[model samples]
Target: VLGLGNVGPLAGKPVMEGKALLFKRFADIDAFDIEVQARDAGHLIDVVAAIAPGFGGINLEDIAAPVCFEVEETLQAMLDIPVFHDDQHGTAVIVAAALQNALELQGKELGRIKVAIVGAGAAGIAIARMLRALGVADIFLSDLHGVLHSGRRDLTQWHKPFAVAPQDWDLAAMLRGADVVIGVSVRGAIPEAALPMLAPKPVIFALANPDPEIDPAVARRLRPDAIIATGRSDMPNQVNNVLGFPFLFRGALDCRARQINQPMLLAAVDMLARLAREPVPDAVQAAYGLTATQGLAFGPEYIIPKPLDPRLRQRVSGAVTVAARESGVARR
Candidate 1:
């Protein structure tokens, strides 16, 4: 995986070890975590190639964006094994699922959805691309400067293709009348007032770490009819990437997938959204140990499944694996 910091107990090692463990639990897969002493892309590529023979697939984790885009592209070109940057694709899969369920609850369609991504970083770009593939034509991306538009002079190559030209530069302006507003940006970016400007029954995914762009309470108050989610575990609708990565990688490894193409990603999305809407099984309820009221149900507060939901890995992995096989990316 491409990631940050010198190898030590405090830094990137714990996450690597955790991912390795998740790999084992979900698919009996083995992984070696290599700490790149330098943050150089070339260095990471060399190290990955040196250890390529032991693995059937490559799972890239936690590498920052823009640079991550180059890294994923490079590794895919260099290695025979399917190279997947989990931060990008994994997050995309879960967001797609969450968006689908959110839209369904609000009685909206993907084609007409107007999405505003607060952060134009890795996760935001991936989500936008995936949403586009899902038939969302109206996507607006915002960075620290303002919303990315065609007239913006200071746009990066990665943000250029999805730029919404000549729109209001203010973030609040972008949120106005938006059907779906996703916050992958910094914490507390979406103030309480901004939430009220959303279209009725909007879909808001405030997916920043630790603290979200907007508090769930604030969002709920601003538009009670709106469907809101976050990256936090404490939140009711936790839009965690855990819903997809372990399973996505498992499927890719199982099938010896050559590439993680769009069809495979969409398949994973469909399966996860469908699973989220499934009748709560006795096993699932037993695992969570929550009451029928607190167990599995569909609403703004109870959208995505908890991490400990036992059915997640099997359900998501099965769909992704089948998708790979059908798309001819999987060898098995």
Candidate 2:
């Protein structure tokens, strides 16, 4: 089952329907999407409880942050089945994959990389935490209020874990020596002037939807060697959550996972990066009706898998379920 809050104009139904189709195709799991409205947490819980009997797991999508945090917490405490908020975790998983791939291409170890994230909201924080868990060195995060350094006076409890002591810094100063810069915030946060400050040929993932923090054309023009990606499909290295959710939920469903933990997410990321380095498999080739023996290659222009590329979910789901079983999070 899927639970969503106030899908605008019913335009969002197609997205849930697409998920259902993918679930049927890849995992053979049947899913129903429901639009929900609630004045408070209690209403959400009551609505979910009314329909919980039919679903093996619940996927929460497109809900805004902070409220999303509360909603997931409420559902987890109340429901017997596993509950996942795909926006928070799904986006994190795919970004983790992109980061890993970027690091690999650079011949750098994950532990030695210095990173900066431009957005400190749910997706940005989740990505930073997961990267830290994977042993990334020195991840600096900033939001609209500027750097999320320690004791800035406006820090929330959620942003506190990532707070560092202020260092008289600006975004360009932080980007000067960082190995990677990720943009999850608003457009044009990372100005073109900052492009040259990156640690010689740094990997840049400007992932804001519609318009990225740094314009892709501008970044490519200024620093011709930088690796760049965005959240839009028209651009190269599109880091769409569409690439993540179907496979991830498919894995959870296949294993009857009790939770979608860090280990499972990490596993999914690893496989996704590795898949981009090789040829598309027979099954995927047949599914896409393609005759090409070689799969998508990894490079500046192709840091991530295309969303329409049929090979993604099969490979990603297999890896995630394997990790779930190993991590003892799988019920099956």
Candidate 3:
């Protein structure tokens, strides 16, 4: 992990350490959390590349965007081994998985839903791309300014391809009648007022950590039929990257994958979604303090596998490894 200071080094350090711990605990994959003091993206890339040969894969975490984009792209191009930025792809995979199951529970198809993604940052872009790969066609993305449409002169190259024709709609307008609203934006971005504007029984993923774009409780009160998820452990259907990166890297490393490509990620999404639909193990239920009386089976509230589920490593890794081989990105 680079840029460990302003991005909350004190907070991020322990999280990275926990990720390293998960890698070892879950998959027996050895990992070291190296904190680099470098601030510049170029310098960080150089630092990571210099040590690339000693590791099987590089997991980039908590680096700020734009620079984070460059760092991951450059490293992935330069390194023979898989280089993954977990914040972008890991979050995307879990969101896709959760969204898949959420849609399934609602009897909605991925191809048919209109998804409005708030916050056109790295994670938002990655999630939109992953969902597109999963057959979601109608996706509308919004930043602070407005919808990312072709007419916007302020648009970056990264935002251009995803842009639609200029629309009169801001965030609320985009959300109106949309089947899904995914918030990768800031806290309180999705106001309570907008909840009633969405299509009935919409899947709302307010996934801003520590605080969501809109509180799930508030969303439920405003639109009782809404399927809600947040980037919070206490909340039901937490869309966490922990359900992804450890096992993903484990599979990639074990298979000697050349890269963590789209196919591999999509495969992980499929596996995660499928796992949610199966019968929950007693241990997994116990870990979440969920009992049979609580009805913790595949439903709106339990759309994705919990982070503590022991079967994740074997299942997700196996799916990812097979994808690496099938996509011809595997070296071994």
Candidate 4:
């Protein structure tokens, strides 16, 4: 079941219905969207716990940050089935997978690079949190006012873990010498002038929907050596959360996993990264209507699997299932 509420107008209808279709399409998992109303995390948790028993796993979607943390954490603890917040962990998993491949293509080491995230919302904060396990240490975040630092009075518990020391640094300041930029904020959050501030062969994931923080073309023009991706499908290297959730839940349910743990998530990330390097299946190429010569190659343009790739079901889900059992979360 996918828990949906508190986003746009009647979000549980359209946004979740689309996801339900994907769940059915990709993993043969029957998912339904439920609109929830609650004043606090306790109320949300109570509502989900009551209905969660009927479903194999609970997927929390569109719930805001900080509250998302409390609700997901409490619900997972209260139930034996996997409880995952797709907005937080799902987006993070895709970003981590795409970034892993991008870094590899650029010959950059995850441990030696600094990442600048331009948004402190659920997606942004979660990306920073998950990257910690991948050996990324220097992460700086920017919100509306400016850079998130120790002196900021507005830092939430979600933002504190990735915050920098008290400083007057802004986006441009943070980009200087940074090796990568992950944008989950509004368009133009990462200005063109700032692209040059990054170190050589940097990675740019301007993943704001509809419009990215920086246009992929502009970024390519300014720094030809850099590898860029956007949330837009028209652009290559779309780092989307849709590439994540269905397979993750399918794996968890197949294994009867107790909860979606870090090991399971890391396993999914690694699976996706590895999938991109393999030769593209003819079915995936034909699904996208690409001719024989215009094949999807593993490069700057295609760092993650297409949403239609059939191999994702067995490969990603199987990897997560293994991790679930090895991590002692799988009941079966």
The model with the greatest TM-score is 4
Predicted structure 1, TM vs. truth = 0.93
Error of 3 at 331 (Å): 2.1
Candidate 3 Cα lDDT to native: 0.88
Give the clashing pairs for model 1.
150-165
Clashes of each: 1, 3, 0, 0
Model 3 clash pairs are none
Alpha-carbon deviation at 28 in model 2, angstroms = 4.3
lDDT of 2 by residue, 1-332 (tens): 12233556266778778877876765567888787756766687688777887888888866666667777878887776778888778888889888788777777778988899998877887888789888985989988878888869887777888887877867777787888999887788998998888887688888776678888999999988778888887676888887787788788888888777778888888888877777655565555455554534467666677666667767888888999999998988
Question: Which residue pairs clash within candidate 4?
Answer: none
Lowest summed-lDDT stretch of 10 residues in model 2? Answer: 1-10
Let me know the TM-score candidate 4 reaches against the reference structure. 0.95
Best by lDDT: 3
Local distance difference test, candidate 1: 0.81
| TM-score for each model | 0.93, 0.87, 0.95, 0.95
Evaluated against the true structure, the overall lDDT of model 4 is 0.88
Which residue pairs collide in model 2, if any?
A: 150-164, 279-295, 280-295
- Model 1, 254-302: lDDT tens digits are 7788877788889889988887787777777777676676676877677
Ranking by TM-score: 4, 3, 1, 2
Q: lDDT per model, in order?
A: 0.81, 0.78, 0.88, 0.88
Error of 4 at 180 (Å): 0.4
